[model samples]
Target chain A: MDRLVESTRELLWERGYVGTSPRAIQQRAGAGQGSMYHHFSGKPELALAAITRTAAELRAEAERQFAAPGTAVERITAYLRRERDVLRGCPIGRLTQDPDVMADPALRRPVEETFTWLRTRLAAVLTEGRDRGELDAALDPSATASTIVAVLQGGYVLARAQNSPAAFTEAVDGALGLLSTASRTPRSG
Target chain B: MDRLVESTRELLWERGYVGTSPRAIQQRAGAGQGSMYHHFSGKPELALAAITRTAAELRAEAERQFAAPGTAVERITAYLRRERDVLRGCPIGRLTQDPDVMADPALRRPVEETFTWLRTRLAAVLTEGRDRGELDAALDPSATASTIVAVLQGGYVLARAQNSPAAFTEAVDGALGLLSTASRTPRSG
Candidate 1:
């Protein structure tokens, strides 16, 4: 059962929802068709489990950076500069490109909730920074939070498009630089 | 011939390379399988033509904003705020998520080149701004350019995830606000 879900997640990431098949998942998991059917009603159920797990994993990983000891900018920097599988792209964000995944509410909920949570969490950090006078008074937390999230998502898109991580790195550096301009104190990383 | 290419482009945008079949393209274009084969070798050939055309159209549209009369920030604002089909995502950038599109060098070239051109073009504008003293001396044109491009691409991802254009607008507004910090002269839009 575990293997089947894991295989579904991997296949979904690599081939997307439309392209992934039950046979392929079963083959990858080293399970028979009967085992897969017994575990889940069908591919949709299996995919939901996989997607939900993937979304949870993404949030936990991001929390590691957000909860780290740092100023708002520093925390964001850690999150942005954290090591990533640039070529493979964001496991959850990549699903936005999958037509079948986006069309299904059950499948799309986890993806949407993850981003909403991220934006809200990042905004709270920024709000804290502003209260502490760490960031410029002019900075808007929610909007800035959206931009920060967008940069990371967009960086993955650019990196995958070029088949290299250079673009992603450059985008991050650029965003970090712009963010620093909004900082009240002179801080170096 | 034009109809076939146009149909392929629309199918590729709607369904991606893997999901789009030649028969579907032919049916959509009102062309028979024989007619499709007569004009192109196969799906790959037809897809290349479609992708290439899409890339060209994207560049042309971006160029319209880039060439418009404005300061660096204004021009970028125009480009970012330019009306877009937020739900549909970017035609060229979306291809990056298609494993088949990224795996093939011939198919991926146009997508890669489009981004390279955008970054270079945007950098040139930023450099011009710095030279004219419209922007701060500390600004890095190349990195800033990458961030701008990333925001737009990332905005699409966010908008699609939530099935709303609000995230995209917020991201653009956030980026524009951050950019104002780098500007030498006070400007309002």
Candidate 2:
């Protein structure tokens, strides 16, 4: 069961839901058809488990930064700088491109919940920064959070498109610079 | 030949490179197998033509904004505000998530070139803004261009993940706000 779920996670990350097949999962997991069937009802059930697990892991990883002691920019910078495979892209964000995954309610639920949680959590942190005057009060927490999340996900897309991590790094630097500049200078009318 | 390539483009946008099949393209185009075969050797060849067309169209669309009379911020805002199927994601950006698309250099080249062209064009416009004293001369054109591109791509990912266009709009607003702030206020030491 564990092997089956782990294989699904890796496959989903690498090829997305549509490209991942039960047969491929089984072959990669080294589990028999019967054993795979015994563990889960079918591919969707197995994939749900994999996606749920991935979402949980993503939240936990993000929480580490959010909970860390720092100004808003520092935590976000840490979150952005956290080691990532720029070319491979975000495991959860990558699934958004898969029509099959997005089409299924059960499969889509975890994805929606995960991003919603991420955005909200980031917003909460930014709000804290605003309360403490670490961020410009003019900056909307929710909007800035959404942009931060977008920059990270979009950075992956640009990096993959260019077949280089430099694009990703440059984007992070630019966004962080913007936030840092805004934090100190505030917006001038 | 036109029908075949157009069909391939539509399928690729909807289902990605891996999910799109020659038979599906042929069916959608109402072209017979002999016609598809005569026009292209196989799926890869047809997809190349389609991707190339999409890249060309994207560049042309961007040029419309870049060529317009405006400050750098105005041009980028125009580019971002241009109507998009925010929920469907960028036609070219979506291909980055496909394992098959990324694996093939022929397929990947157009994607790479398109983004590279976009970044360079945006950077050039920003450089002009600096020269014209409309933007902070301290800003890195290449890095800022990457962030703009990333926000668009990331906006798509966030919107798709949340199953809404609100996230996309919010992200765009946030990035644009940052650029606007930067444009008006030179970085303070």
Q: Pick the candidate with the highest DockQ.
A: 1
Question: What i-RMS does each candidate reach, in Å?
Answer: 4.8, 3.2
* Deviation of model 2 at A59, angstroms: 1.2
DockQ, all models: 0.55, 0.54
Estimated TM-score for each candidate: 0.91, 0.90
Query: Which residue pairs show backbone clashes in model 2?
Result: none
TM-score of 2: 0.90
Q: What is the two-chain DockQ of model 1?
A: 0.55
Native contacts conserved, per model: 0.82, 0.67
- How well does model 2 score by local distance difference test? 0.88
For model 2, the stretches where C-alpha displacement exceeds 4 angstroms are A19-39, A185-189, B18-42, B185-189
Write one digit per residue (lDDT tens) for candidate 2, span B1-189.
Answer: 999999999898777776798889999999999988987999999999999999999999999999999888889899998989888779899888777898999999999999999999999998999888887666788888889899999999988888889889999999877776567454454
Report the TM-score of the second chain of model 1 against its true counterpart. Answer: 0.94
- Worst-scoring 10-residue span by lDDT in model 1 chain A: A180-189
Q: Which ten residues in a row have the lowest lDDT in candidate 2 chain A?
A: A180-189
| Tens-digit lDDT track of model 1 for B1-189 | 999999999898777788799899999999988898999999999999998888889889989988889898999999999888888788888888778898999999999999999999999999998999988888999999999999999999999999999999999999998998888765443
Error of 1 at B21 (Å): 4.1
Question: What is the docking quality class of candidate 2?
Answer: medium
